[model samples]
Target chain A: MIHPSAKIGKNVVLGQSVVIEENAEIGDDAEIGHHVIIKKDTKIGNRVKVGDLSVLGKTTSKNKKMARKPGAALTPLVIEDDVRIGCNTVLYRNLLLKQGAFVGDLSSIREKVTVGEDSIIGRNVIVETNTVIGSRVTVQTGCYVTADMIIEDDVFLGPCVSTSNDKYMGEGNYPYQGPIIKKGAKVGNNATLLPGITIGEKAIIGAGATVTKDVEAGKTAVGNPARVIK
Target chain B: MIHPSAKIGKNVVLGQSVVIEENAEIGDDAEIGHHVIIKKDTKIGNRVKVGDLSVLGKTTSKNKKMARKPGAALTPLVIEDDVRIGCNTVLYRNLLLKQGAFVGDLSSIREKVTVGEDSIIGRNVIVETNTVIGSRVTVQTGCYVTADMIIEDDVFLGPCVSTSNDKYMGEGNYPYQGPIIKKGAKVGNNATLLPGITIGEKAIIGAGATVTKDVEAGKTAVGNPARVIK
Candidate 1:
């Protein structure tokens, strides 16, 4: 079911029962699988392979807390060229995926998150709201990138890695503080980065380690509360 | 692109470009949306609304080290009568959704997960393999129920809640050590339930609480390591 207002470019192969909502723009040579939903005001890039049961442009966070009363600004989601989005992936509104980014199956990328060019997000990765992942990064399966973290370029995040942003976890507080991961860092599988900490460039965080403080550049850290290993 | 071997019952309303693979069975009065994919060995129940881009009978966790090998067992997905599956939802092989079960938009239910009768799985919820959810349960938005968890009847799971079964998570390590959530339990938003912990019957888990131990029945748990509040 394609709306009359939906802008579909030439040679776009749409499989059975696809729904293209109003004002959605699909670029040329994009392959959309069956039963996919492209919601309103969404724009899909060229040569993109949108797998089955995938939903794009749904706004996940629309509450009274996010409302600016009447004349507030609303952001749009932009997916750049040659991206491959796997089956059942959900890309909410106000997000941007740069060129050649790959999101594996069953991933949930929340609002305002940006995956930079050529980054690979593996299966079941939950990237929370407003997190920025830089270019050529590899976030492995089951990683949880919590809100407001900055993951710089050339970082490698292993499976089930988790990061938090709030120090007191916003307990009884409204605005929460976030964390950052600098460029060229590597976080191993199941590693936990506590809130408000930063990982410097070229640092290595071992598997299942918990980082409670800032990690220096080119160092390796491990264990709970993470002492510097190198 | 419905295969000739597919069995479509009477009064089925097939939307534009829907694909029903070989041996797939569509029950009476099922409404399939455009571009939906009903892969092989899938059984759709009567009066079901399979939304656009929704995929049924796709692959599950057989490729993972924690799961059974591929071709060790293969079973069809059985979606019972009166189910309303929203757009971009994926039901992999061996899944069973009982009558009146409603899976909201962008949800992914992996292999062998059973949603009991009248259960409502909210938007973007992820149910990993082999989980058994009881009747009339409400799993809210953005929650992740990892593999092999038992959620009893009438449980209420809030947004972004997570349950872990694996204490030591890795390849060849089956992370299914988490305790069951007894009947009528209510887990609030963004709560984390660590491995090997049980939430007793009628227990209330507070928002953003990190639960590391067992919660007694009919109690309210809050804070990190989740002490009983009431």
Candidate 2:
């Protein structure tokens, strides 16, 4: 059932028993699976295949400890053209999946996470809060990307890769810093990149490597306190 | 439409245009979302809420390198009674969500994971393969539990927390040992628990802490190479 305030483009195929909430927008030739929930202020682009049981744009207040006020401005989730969001994937508010980005099944993109154009997020990837993923990046299955990390363009994150963002973690308020991964870098499977470390462009982080320092461009690093191997 | 191969119990109230796939078993009074894909051999228990765009027992075999064989036997997903699975949550093959377990919206439980009874897994939590989460545990929002982790009962994992399973993290094969979090432990927000460590019972890991060694019971730990403060 499309709500009266919902905007539907021409030739949009909504499967039987679909529920579109108020102020949602579905573009032309979009196929919405059965029982999907497109909540308020969400925009679905043309020709997108939104699989069943997926919920988009469910708004909630940010963590009270991180916010200036109890209630803040609510932003909508925007999905650009030619994006194929797989089954059971959820995109919350303030998420923008640029054109041709493919989020595999069961992937979750948190708020303020911008997946650049043509990036591929594999299945079951948990992209934590405020991480910016660059265009044409490939994050394989089951990667845990912690908050405030920046993955630049053409980066390859292997399956089950891990990244951290805080160096001296404490309970009370602490200074916040962001980690940067430069373009064309490759982080191997199950690798652990520590907080505030930068991986230069085209650097290769070996599988299972624990990187604690910045790797120069085109170098290879590995180990517990990862040292440059090449 | 319940397939003939599907076994549904009495008093089940399926909403309009619900689709149950082959060999799926639904218990009494269960409410399945419309267009939800309860795939083959899934067992959903009584009074469960399988929300919209949510897919149960949908396993992807593309990651064949991680399996023992190229393609091993496909096991069923079992959900016990009173499980409240929210929108777009996905349980892959051989997952067992024990009685009274609550999986928040957009979470993903990968293959062979067991979520213990009455455990509350918050929004966007991703439990990777073979992780065993104990009863009454609470994994808060955006936490990533890596493979083969043993989280005991009454454990509290905060937002954006992560655990590693591999030490060297080499490719093609995962070679690192898993970590164990003992009962009544609390891992704080944005914390990182390295592999092969054991967090003792009643220990409190501070927010943004990076735990490296085995923590003693009732201690509070924090820092880059986390040390016990109390």
Candidate 1 error regions (>4 Å): A1-50, A53-85, A88-102, A106-196, A199-230, B61-71, B169-175
Model 2 segments more than 4 A misplaced? A1-85, A90-102, A106-120, A123-198, A201-215, A218-230, B61-71, B173-176
lDDT of 1 by residue, A108-220 (tens): 79777899988888667888876889988887666888877889998887656787766664363535545678887877555678877888988887654678998998899
Residue-level lDDT of model 1, residues B1-230, one tens digit each, is 98999999999998777888989999999999876889998998899988876778876431111234555566999999999999877778899999999999877888878999999999877787778999999999877787778999999999877666655433337646545899999998877776678999999999867687899999999875478978
Tens-digit lDDT string for candidate 2 (A52-167) = 66678866545647633333665899998878776766778888988878787777787878999888887777787678999888887668788788999988886667787667
Best by lDDT: 1
Clash count of each predicted structure: 18, 9
> Scoring each candidate complex against the real one, what DockQ results?
0.12, 0.12
Model 1 chain B worst lDDT window (10 residues): B60-69
lDDT scores in order: 0.80, 0.79
